[model samples]
Target: MTDGLTLRLKYLCGRYWRLLVPVLVLLSAIAFAGAAAGVTSDAQPQQTTVETDSMTVETTLSTEATVTGNTTLYEQNDTLTNLPVYLRSATPEVRLIAVTTTPPDRTVSVTQQIVLRLSATRNGEVFWRDSRVLAADSTNVTNGSTQTTATLDVQQLARERLAEVRAETGNVGTVRVEVETIAVYQTDAYSGRTSAATPVRVTERAYELETPQRDQQTNVTTEQQTAAGGAGGAGPLSVSNGPALRDLGAGLGGFVALGLAALVWLTSRRIGDFDTFRQRYERVRYAEWISRGSVPATGRHARVPVETLVDLVDIAIDSEKRVIYDVSKGVYAVVDENLMYEFRENNDGDMNEFGFVPITEPTESGSTEKTSSDDGAETAAAADSWFDADTEPPDHDSDASPDDGS
Candidate 1:
C-alpha cells in the first residue's frame, strides 16, 4: 500500500512539479498568518465589560380624594383613594404627592419643587386663572429618596372659579386644576469626552383634575404623569471574533496543506526527458509511415533490430513498405524479402539494441522455422507469414495511398 502511494505521488509530481514551490510558499504563509491571528486574540483579551459610573432618576405622582361632608352617599366621613369619579355634593378633598428616587451609591443630594394652578377656559381662552407654590425646593444630601405633598378642596375651588367666570361673561366654562412637581438629583456619574459636568438629572410629575356634570351628579376625575432621567459614563463593549470552530478549522487546513507540500517535495521523483522527447518527435515526423496494429508472427525471415524509429524508417523506405507499430507490444517493424526490421522504445535506459536469433533457411518445399530464445518455442513456423493473403498487415497511414510506400 505504501509503495503504491509513493509511486502515485511520484507520477503526479513528475507531471506537476513546477507548481510545487508556489503552492508550498502560499500554504506556509497562510499557516503563519493563522498562528499570528490566534496569538493576537490570546494576547489581547476581549473587553467584556468596562468600569462605568451611572445614575438613574425617576419621579412618580400620586393623588387621593377624601369626602369632607356628611351626605347620603357615605357615613360621617369617607376618604377615597384613586376613585374613578367623585361627586361634588360629597365635598371631596384632593391631595397630590410627588416622589423622586435615585440609586443610593450615586446620590449626592436631591431637591423637589411643587406648583399648583387653577384655570377656567371657554373656547381655548382662559378668562380666570389662579396659581400657588405648594412646596419650595429643598435638598437632602444624605439619601436618594425625596417626597412633596399638597392638599386642596377641588369641588369648592372649581365651583367658585366657574361661578365668577359665568357671572362676568355669562359663559359656563370648564374648570381645570393642574399640579406640577420638579425634582433635581445630583450624582458623580458622567459620560462623554469633554470635562465631566456635575452629573445632574431633573424629573417632573404632573397631576391634573377633570369634572363632568350630569342631571343630578357632578363627577371629578384625576390623572397623574410620570417622568424619568439618567446619567452614565462609558459602558462595556460587546464584540466577538466569531466561533472557535471556524478559527480552528482554518488553522488546521493551513497546516494540512503545508504537510502535503512537504511530503510531495521529499518523496516525489520526476520522469526524465529522454522518453518524452523521443515519443513526441517520432510520432510527429514519421506519422505518415506508421500503422497501428499487432505485428504478425515471423516465418522464413530473420530479425534485424535497430536503435530508433529513424533507422527503422530508413529500412522501410528501402524496402518500399509501411512501418507497422504494435501498440500493445510497443514495437515498430517492417517486413521485406527475408528480413524483419524492428525498433522499440527503451524506457529502462538500456542502450543495447542488437540480439542474435538463429533461423533455419527455407527448404525445397519453401518452408522455414525459427525457435524463440527464451521459451524455446518454434513460433516462426506457427502460422502464415506477414506477406501471405491470410496474414496481411493493417492498413497504411491515412495520408498514404496503396502505391505510396514508406
Candidate 2:
C-alpha cells in the first residue's frame, strides 16, 4: 500500500530473520518426526500380523463323535482329517472306523495313522494297559477320487486283558479307563503333523465278562507303559504362538507417542562423526547376526532406510569394503573394483594413494586416421590459426626490446 509501511515491514524481517529461521526449522523438524513415527509405528505391526497368520496352524480335539459327512477343508488343498478320537471300552464290542477320503491335492501320497491306547486304573493306580495301532488303510490317489476304510475290532484286544483289566473295574474306588487316540499324518510335500485327541474317559460303563478265548497275549511291557504316559512329542501347534490380530491394534495410539519420542531422540540429538557411525553399524550387524532369520536380507546396493542404517559411515566400516554413496540414487554400494578407471588423466597422486595406477597400453580401438598432407609446418600453422580468434596479438608499434641492440 504505502512505501513507509513496506520499508518498515522489510526492516523488521531483516532484523530478526536469523532467529526466526532457526525456530521455523525446529518446528518443521518436530512436525516431520512426529508424522513419520506415527505412520511407521501404526503400519509395522499390522504387516507383521498378516504375515504371522499365514504361517500359523492350530489343532484342537473335537468332542463330537458323529462323523459329519465327507467335508472339503481348505478348498483346492482338499484337506481330509481322520475321525476324531472316541472312547474305547475294554469289554464292549467297539467297532471303530478309519475312512481315508480323497483330498484335492493328492498328486502326492498322504497317509494317516491313528493309535489307540487303553489304560485301566483302580484308585489312581494303573494295573493293566494295552495300545493298538488301529487298522488304517491310506492308499495313494492313483486314478480318481477313491475311498478306503478300516474298522478296528476292540473285542480281541479286550480279551487279551480280560482278567487284568476287568478285575480293576470291580474294585471299590473309581475305576478309570483312560483312552488316548493320537493321529499322525505325512504329506506328499515330505512334511508331517502329529495331533492328539483329548484323552476320553470310558469309566462309568460296566464291562461284560464273556467266555475266555485263547489268543496270543503279549503282556504290556513296563517301559512301554511309562513311555506312553510321559510322552515328549511334537510341541503344541505353532499357530497358537502367533500374535492375535485383535491384540496388535491395541495401544497403537500409545505406540505412536512412544515412536515420536524415539524419533525426536534420534533426530534432535547430535549425530556423532564417522567413528561413532562405524561403532553403531558394527553393533547393528552383530545384532542381525545373532538374530539371523529376524532380519531379512537386503540386496546389493539397495538404499537402506534411516531406520535400518542409522549412520552411513557406520555401514561403510561394518562392511569393511569400498563404500560408494550415490546421492541422486539414494543408494550405497560396497564394491571391490576400482571406480577411477576413466579418470586416468589426473596428475595429482590421489588416485595412486588409493592403489589405482593408470594402466597405459596400446589402444584396443581400431587404427587411427592418417593425415593426407604430411607437413609439420602446416600442422603448426593450423594449431596457431585455431587459437588466433581468441588470442590477442602482440603490437609491433610498442617499444621492441630497447629500440636498438644494446
Candidate 3:
C-alpha cells in the first residue's frame, strides 16, 4: 500500500511541476523589478543651495550761501512838506498871462492883471505885510490899500519862469482863478510863510475891428435896380416876352405838376396794397392755411365735413346778434371798426379770433352699459329713470288702419 501511494504522489507531482516553474519565474521577475525601482528612487539627484554676500552703501552732501549790499543816494530837502498847493487862475476864459521872477516888457503888460495880498502871523498875533505891487505902467499908489495889481503879457514870459514858480509854490495839484486873488489862504501862518504866484487864464475880449458900412450913393444905386426889377420884370427872361421862353416855362410847370400827381398816385396805390396784404396775412385762418394747408381730416377713413371745415374759419357767436363779414366771400376779412375798438378795449389789443379746442371720440352704448353695470343697483335704477324720461315711446295704435274706411 505504501509503494502504491508513493507512485500516485510522484505522478501528481510531475503533472503540477510545469505550473509551479512558471509561478516561481514570475515571482523572481517581480522581486528583481521591485529591487531595481528601489535602487533608482534612492539614487535620484538632489538640488544644491548656493550662498552669496550682501552689500550696503552710504552718501552725504553739503551746501553754502553768501549775501552782500551797500549803496548811497543824495537826500532831498524836507523844508516843504510835499503837500500840494493848488494854483487856480482868476478866470477859465483867460490862459496863462506871465510867470517871472522879475517884471516883464511893455508888450507883455497889456493883456492880463495880477493882484496880491500878503499877511503874516507870528506867535499868536496877526499882521498885514506888503499890500501893493503895482504894474510898471501904473503911477497912482500911496499904500494902505490891501490889494496890488500888476499887468503882464501872456506870450512874452519865458517857460523857465513858469517852471520855477510851479516848483516853489508846489502848485502841482490844480490851478484855478477868478479875477486875481491868492488861491491858498494861510490857515496856519508863522514859521516863514511863502507863496509864488503863477498866472493862467484864457482871454475872452474881442480884438478885431467892426465891419464898415457902404456909401449912400452905392447903396442907392443897388436899391433902384432892385426896385425896377420888382416893379415889372421879376424873374429871368421876364423882360424878354419871347415865345421860346414862355413855352419852356409852361412845359416845366406842366412837367412838375404831372410828376407830383404821379407821385401821389403811386403812394396811394402802395398804401392800398399794403392794407390789403395786412388784412389777408394777419387773419388766423389765412396764416394757418399759408403755413400748413387746410386743417387735417378727422381720421384716415373719416371725411372732413364741409360745414365743419367752413365753421373753423367762421366768426364766433356770443349773444343773439350775428356778426357777418363785411365783404362777401373775400379772402381777406377785416373786423368792423366798432367791433375792433370794443375788442381792443376789453382784451388788451390781442386780435386772436380762432382758439384751440380738443377733439374727443363719442362714447359707445356698450361702454355706457358696462359703466352702468359697474355702478351699484341703486345708481343703475336712477340712470334708467332719467333715460326713460329723456326718450318718448313710439305710438303703436297710430299704425292700425280703420276697418270701415278700408
Candidate 4:
C-alpha cells in the first residue's frame, strides 16, 4: 500500500501540476536543507601535509644540477628542453634532518660511522607547513664577509703523497667533518659571485648516540585542534540539516490528495462512459423526486389505457379537454399538482380510445352468464354501487302540479 501510494503521488504530480506544486517545493526544501547540513559539517577536519624526517644519509651527488630559476616551465612550454618544468624546482630550506651512529649507544666504541641526512622541500615556493610548537632556543649567527679561498672538494682514496702530508699532523681519534649544503647556482660555474648557499638548520647530539629508555606505563593524552568557529579539522566539507519543513508539507499534501480520491471512490461506483453517466443521472433525479413526495419523471409517456391503471393513475389533459398519452414521455403533462382529470371510482373503470375495455368483476359463482349491458353503463353502475349493491330510481314529490307529466 505504501509503495502504491508513492507511485500514485508521482503520477498525480505529472498529471495535476497545479495541485502538486506546493508538495514539490516542500520536498525540494527538505533535500536542500539536508544537503546544506552535510556541506557545513564537511568543513571541519583538514588533513595537514604530513612530513617524515629523513632517516638515512646518502653520499652520492648529482653532477648536472637540479635547481631551476623559472616557474613557468610546468605547462606546454617548448622552451624547457632538458626536463619538464614541473619536475624542476629550487630546493627549499632543510625539511628533514636525522643523525644516527653505526652502533647505537656503546660503552666501548672500537670503530663507528656518523651518518647525517637532510631532506628539502620540492620547490622553493613558500607554503605554510603545519607544525607543532615543540621548542625554541637562541642561535649564534655569524656575520662574516670579504673572504677568498681556493679549495678542491671530492671523495676518493688518499694518494701516497697526501697520506704522508696528513700523517705529519699526527692527530689520532680525530675525524674531519664535511658539510654538504644545497646551493642555487645562478650561473654555470662554481664561482663565488653567481651562487648562494641556502640556509640549513643542523642539530647534533650532545652526548654519544644511544637508544632512549621509555617508561612503559605512561599515559598518552590527546587534544583537539580547533580551527575558527570551533570547527575541527581542515578540508572540503558537506552540510545536511535532515528533513525540513518542505518535506513535512509534501507528506501532508500527499495524504490530503489521497483522502480526496478516497472520498470520490466511496461515494459512487465507477462510471465507465457517458451512457452510464446518463443512466445514473436519471436514477438520481427520479429518486430525488420520490424523496420529495412527487411523482418520478420518465420523459417518455407510456400510452397506458385509462382502465389499465383504473382510478389509481393520475391523468393529464390536452387543449381539447381529452386525456393525452405521450408515447415518448411516460409522465403526465399536468400543469399543476391540484389539477387532474378523474377517470372513474371503480377499479376497472373506463375504456381508452384504443378500444381497451376494462374487465368488470365476475358475477357471483352460479351466475356466470353475460349481462345485457353496455360496457359504459356497467362502468357507471359499478361506480355508483361501490359499497351499495342496488341502484334506486328517482322519486317524484306529491306536490307536483297536474301538468308536471308534460
Name the top lDDT candidate.
Answer: 1
**Predicted candidate 1 versus true structure: per-residue lDDT over 1-406, tens digit per residue:** 4533444445466456569856876977787687557544544433333323345556665656666665787665567664445555564466666666655654345666566666678898998887777775566545656667777655555557534644665546765556666665544542111010111011121123432111111112234322111011111111242423344666777878788777665533323452443443344356677765446566656888898888888888887888876543456889887888888766621111111122233433566644445532232222122112222222333233523322
* Among all candidates shown, the one with the greatest TM-score: 1
Taking the tens digit of each residue's C-alpha lDDT, what string does model 3 give over 156-225? Answer: 2223333344355462232222223221111111111112342233223211111111111000111122
Note the residue pairs that clash in candidate 1: none
Q: Between the candidate structures 1 and 4, which one is better when assessed by lDDT?
A: 1
> For candidate 4, lDDT tens digit of each residue in 1-406?
4533433343343345444455545555555565455455544443344333211111111111222334453333333221211122331111111111111221111111112322222244322222221112221112211111111111111233224434653443222222222211111211111111112121221111111111111112344444432133323321221223333444456555555555444322322232322322222222212111112232333322243221212332222232222211222222233344322212221331111232332333434323235765764444333212222221122232323211
By TM-score, rank the candidates, best first: 1, 2, 4, 3
Better of 2 and 3 by lDDT: 2
lDDT comparing candidate 3 with the true structure? 0.27
List runs of model 1 lying over 4 Å from the truth: 1-21, 37-55, 69-78, 83-91, 102-107, 117-132, 141-144, 160-178, 187-253, 264-406
Clashes in each model (backbone N, CA, C under 3 Å)?
A: 0, 1, 17, 29
In model 3, what is the error at residue 186, expressed in angstroms?
34
RMSD of 1: 17.7
The estimated TM-scores of all candidates read 0.42, 0.28, 0.15, 0.17
Give all candidates' CA lDDT scores. 0.51, 0.33, 0.27, 0.27
Candidate 3 residue spans exceeding 4 A from truth: 1-117, 120-406
lDDT, residue 271, candidate 3: 34
Q: Model 1 reaches what TM-score against the true structure?
A: 0.42
